[model samples]
Target: MSWLVDKDWWMKTYRGLIVKSMKLSFEMDQQATDLLSKMLDGRGNVIEFDEMKNLFKEYNESIVFGCGPSLLPDLDFLLESGNLRNKLLISADGATSVLINHDIIPHIVVTDLDGLIADIAWASLKGSVIVIHAHGDNIERIERFVPMFKGRLIGSTQVEPRPHVYNFGGFTDGDRGVFLSRTLGILRITLAGFDLNGEPYSCPGKLVPFNKRIKKKKLEVAKTLLKELVSKGVGFFNVRGEPYVL
Candidate 1:
C-alpha cells in the first residue's frame, strides 16, 4: 500500500507501460484492450465488457471537462455560445459543479468519487444521467450511485486482464470524454479548459510534474487521433470567449 503512494519508480514504470500500451491499442483499434489497461492502474480490477459498450451507446455528443473551478471563468460564455446545444456532456467525477454553478446542466456525470458525491446525487436527481466508473475498490460508490440515479453504468474495460483506458490522448477523462464524443458521430467538438500540456494552475487544477509528463504524452496521442478524426470529417475547436476551430 505504501509503495502505491511513495514509490516513484513503481508509478513511472507502470503508468509508462500503460501509456505505451495505449499507443499500440490505438494503432490497432483494440479499444477494449486499451480500456482494460487504463482501469487496472497496476493494482487490480476486472472490467465488464458488454456493459461498457452499452454505456458508450447512450449518447450522441459528449462534452467532457475537468471542472476544476477554474472553468468557471468560461462557463457562462460557453453555455450561451450555442455550440454545445444538443451535445451530451460527460462531466468528470468531481468537475460537475462547474456546470451546475453556472446553470448549465450536463446530460451525464461520470466519476470515481474523489470529491463532491453530494453534487453527483443532485445532478442525477435533477435528471442528469450518471455513469459511475466501477472498479474492485469503489464498490460502495457504485452501489450507492446505481440505486440513486436513472442512468446507465459503463463498466471500464481497463478493469480486465491487462487493462487500458483509450481516451484519444486528452490526458484524463475530459479528453476521453471528447474522444468518445467524436467517435459517436459528433461532427464538431470544442474543448473548454482541456489544457493538455498546460500547467493545471487554475480552471482544471494542477497536475504534478510526473503526471504532467504523462499528460504531454497523451496530448501527442490526442493530436494524432484528432488528425485521424478530422480525416474522417470531424472538426475540433477550443472555446474560451469564442470557439476557435483548430
Candidate 2:
C-alpha cells in the first residue's frame, strides 16, 4: 500500500480506537476521568495541535531519544556524526537529563513526569516544550509537577483527548515521541537509546528502583507500537550500536 493510503487508514483506525477507549474510560473509571478533568481545568498555556504542527513545519526528520541503558553510547555516536542539527531532537522523559547534561536541549520532551522531574522542569525552562501525559496511574505526579513547569507545556492523555489534553496514540513516553512525530507527518524517524533487548536501568532523576520485569513489559509494548507504525508505512530507523531488529 502507498504511504498516503496507509496514513489515511492508520489515522482512521487510530481515531476509532481513541473513541472506543474514551467510551470505556467513561464507563469504567468515571471518577478518574473526572479527577483528571478537574486537574486540567484551570491549566493555561496548553499547547495546541497547530502550534506543534508549526514547530515541525520545516523539519522532515526527527530523532527521538529513549532512556534505555544504551542511550548515552548511542548519543555519543550521533553527536560525533554531527547529523543531529538537521533533525528535531525529542527526548523521552528520563533521557531529558542525559541530553541536557551533554549540552543538547531537545526540541521536545515527552514525559509522564515519572522520570527526573527536576531535569524535565529545567528542560521546560530552557524552551523545550514538554508533552505531559496524564493517566489514572499518574494523577498525583501530574498534580505535583505540572505546576512546576516554567515554559511551554502540552497535555496528553491515554483516554479521550479533552479541551486541553490531546491523544496522539502511544502508551510510553518513547513511543509517544514517535507517535507525535508520525502524527505531524515527519518523513523519517531515527531512534536512539532504545534498546528493547538491553539491560534495564533505573529511571533518571529519581530514587525509585528499577524493575526489570516492568521495564521489559513496557519495552515490549513500545516495540509493538512502533512496529505497528512501521507496518502502516511510517519510516522508523534504529541507530543503536548493536543490531536492533524492528
- Among all candidates shown, the one with the greatest TM-score: 2
Supply every candidate's count of residue pairs whose N, Cα or C atoms clash at under 3 angstroms: 18, 0
Off by over 4 Å in 2: 1-37, 40-44, 207-209, 240-244
Candidate 1 lDDT tens digits, 1-246: 001111353235325654474443332233333432443444322223333445456555455665543465545566677756665666765577667766666765656444466676778667565544433334444445445443333333222223233222222445445545654556666666555445533323222232545545655555454554566666666554234333
Q: Give a tens-digit lDDT track for model 2, residues 150-190.
A: 78777776555565567677767998898888878885888
TM-score of each: 0.57, 0.83
Q: Backbone clash tally for model 2? A: 0
Q: For every candidate structure, what is the RMSD over all alpha carbons to the true structure, in angstroms?
A: 9.6, 5.1
